[model samples]
Target chain A: MSTHARPRIGEQHCQECLVSIGPERIREEFPTLWTKVHGKPLVYLDNAATTQKPRSVIEALTRYYTEENSNVHRGVHLLSQVATQAYESGRTKVRQFVNAAHDREIIFTRGTTEGINLVAQTYGRRALRAGDEVLISAMEHHSNIVPWQMICEEKGAALKVIPMNDAGELLLEEYRRLLTDRTKLVAVTHVSNALGTVNPIQDVIALAHGRGIPVLVDGAQAVSHMPVDVRELDCDFYAFSGHKLFGPTGIGILYGKAYLLEAMPPYQGGGDMISAVTFEKTIYNTLPYKFEAGTPHIAGVIGLAAAIEYVERVGRNQIAAYEADLLAYGTEILTAVPGLRLIGTARDKAGVLSFVLDGIHAHDVGTILDLEGVAVRAGHHCAMPVMKRFGLPATARASLAFYNTRADLDALAKGLHKVREVFA
Target chain B: MSDLRELYQQVILDHYKRPRNFKKLDGATRQAEGNNPLCGDQITVYLHMDGDLIRDISFEGAGCAISQSAASLMTTVLKGKTKAEAGALFEKFHEMVTGGENAVDPMELGKLAVFCGVKEFPVRVKCASLPWHTMRAALEGQNGSVSTE
Candidate 1:
């Protein structure tokens, strides 16, 4: 604790509020944003793919491997115990962050991809029968789509999609109609990683629940942008990755309902996930351990905990508000560009701006922008369905974060002008 | 830098704007579609092969300037060349774009020399070589699409 760590009355939203003493200030804590590319300041607007880590999270990772490096669980040594405590602390942080009912419900997997696969393999493998349907929306990332597809294919079940409008919003009536007794599961994204469409998960969950169906919400793009209380959302399962939230990669959380997790079989059977094993018989461990099969990514988990702390300290509400303002500013400027067409114009959106310019390919736009030291992602964004729906080969996406300012958006607009000039 | 300017030379831009042989060949003996799925660069190579000689060549697709121009320039140079000669030229051109600048003379490449500067950008090497790979695939009488991963 430092003398300047405490937040004053109105300062509760910026930098420090809950910390007893000196917590690092929000943007100042991140040093990567100040990096220079090709003699220009790096204006990184590609936060959707992955986020830059803060000093605290980086330090936590280094501290873990440097000081308390040991295997977790079933160790009597001090280093192992400390490592185990740190790892379990990370799980507790996730449980609190998502407000899951039980700590045992928080399972740490590799990332969102593995988390989705874990659920799809364990729950979906058992739940889905032949001719059953797994309902999903049109705007889901490949992660949410492929896992269910794999399980459905294996189980002889069909994968059904709830189509979206041209504005990129999911049709609730279509979703409702798609929900049938044979619909084993509903998987939808809390936010579209490609379009930034914030889905109505509450209504989605309620509708699915009325039919006694479980819904899995992919919060990989939602958690960092806004506060997410899974208990409040009442989603049966929620999954998200650590790196997307400013933590290291190779770590993620899967929060499943206690009863559902208990009823489902273990995703993987290994040392940590087993109570006892023999040549003839094997008993599985408890909820969280049953899914986490191997020695987990200890440093990544610790870093994730620090990242969660960092986001909480900065205040998710403030992040949501700041990015909302950035989105509005970006939309206004980008839509006003001479020949630019904004792709995803959902009524409610955040963190993404995808568009196309007349007579210019998205890759060329990306290259020219890169020359100007602006990093924007130009591709299908792993949501090829979204691109196909919009009848575009690809799109230039400039996703924003809390660290971005009006100057960054202005630079993006200026870069578009340069792209226009280059083509002309 | 001079390298970036050279990579996007005026001639390359012109060819990109008005590609030389961007049409479906009437009597095509061989054809193959290729795509770089990452950037959505798609091209269909149509080869009018008279026995072993490529009497005419054409392409149709949408890609970045470097890819489209490289493909356009390839079609112009490969016309009337024997299949063996085309393969030999592909090797030389690939070496020029992906190899060291001093390894091959730009004057030896003629109009295709503009793409020699693409070697400065390791990522753009694929963009410059994608059409060549697809051409090689088509000359081999293959029907599958090629990908520059």
Candidate 2:
């Protein structure tokens, strides 16, 4: 078997001269997004949970399983080499996607949850001394909070919370006050998954940097909706999941600064992450390889790269603009319904509308909406603290993607009326 | 589908709207809180036990129509029955709502006949039985809140 030229992603699958995607193209490409639920055209507004995959991403996974099904970076055969190249290209794509300085900084994990746990167990456990504090926001998802709690608990370090105001925006003044000599690390979400508040991460990072404290930004909710530049933010660490970005589940990116990753211990000990294994003393692999233990999700990486490419082709600016319109439209229409109360009204928010109907539980609203083929999440949204902050049990949330339309919001509005009718 | 209709029948809605015995029992012999973590629904069952017979009962909580109404109906049926009878009723009701192969007759359930629609929705079975489970916990004297994970 001969080593061929560089990994090309099989050009026939993706034409190089492809046009940038718009909302129209998104509708046409995502056949599942337009599926009929209960004989009604599916109006999916649960994008925050997971974005629907484009045709390219699905095909990428299909092609990988069909042709390039082999272990990466080990075998001398052509298939293994091709798979390794594709996987490496995935890392490069992730690096560029987040504007990281180097591909070596990227580590693959299960998703946002595992990424946080990785940092918590490795960097957090190693760096934090007793009486030290790890500060997080009130609006953070449980994934962002629980891992820190677990690590802080084990390390005998305290977990401090940055409270938010009624609008669901983190109180920066309070955050400034919370900062002290003992504040070892600050973990904040780039955009709140529950409240949809886009945090002032740059300002947060600068403040932490002043105190000589490193910050970890949870970018799971923000990456799909906006452009992220780790170099621009100068954050020590950033993490995001692939499923939320229209790729397969069980794959995510954890992009840390190289120096920090070097100092931290490897997350897990397993194969592909070892330079040499010995009974007495085993040496870990360098940079990324050290962090990426075991056989990685080869197909997932390729699919994620495809998803990132699809996002790139769609033009982040175009997607952002379209989603903004949808958000405005959704807010206005959802607000018009009688007795409806919007939960999070932060000035800076992503494409999420969380609300409650008077005298009706969110679960009831969700059940009624499901009959009409409108999918919206009605629960604490894995952000129990956010729900607690608002003094609510749960809220009905409709989060948007570029593919979602004003008509979908209308379906939601119509469905809410049925909810009211049932109670009335 | 008519499943929604069956799940939210007028009787269930009426019970939800104006629940029977939905006041805090100030002097309760036993009590247990039931919480559905998924929906953030909470129900507390208060049993005033007099020997084997439940002399009086009341409840107070907030939840979906199915859960609240089921709790209300539970409080009503459990008033005159002995502890053993309530336990039997709970078992029969559980089987009816979960659509067990040993399903009870709808006529046997009476007002609970409306809950026959709940059998179709496996997820909501917890909603319908949260109060019954809480009452069982209250009787058995569990330490803390009962959660339907």
Off by over 4 Å in 2: A1-24
**lDDT: worst 10-residue window of model 2 chain B:** B1-10
In the order shown, the candidates' DockQ scores are: 0.64, 0.75
**Candidate 1, position A220, lDDT:** 95
**Reference-based lDDT, each prediction:** 0.89, 0.89
lDDT of 2 by residue, A1-424 (tens): 1122432222332433222333554577786887897788899999999989877888899899999999998999999999999999999999999899999999998898888999999999898888999999998899999999998888899999999899988899999999999999999999988888899999999999999999999999999888899999999999999999999999999999999999999989999889999899899999899988999999999999999988886667666777777788888998999999999888989988999999898988888798789999989999998898888999999998878877889999999988898899
Q: Which regions of candidate 1 fall more than 4 Å away from where they truly are? A: A1-25, B1-3, B100-102
Candidate 2 lDDT (Cα, whole model)? 0.89
User: Which pairs clash in the backbone of model 1?
Assistant: A2-A22, A5-A21, A5-A22
In model 1, what is the error at residue A248, expressed in angstroms? Answer: 0.5
Q: What 10-residue stretch in candidate 1 chain B is worst by lDDT? A: B1-10
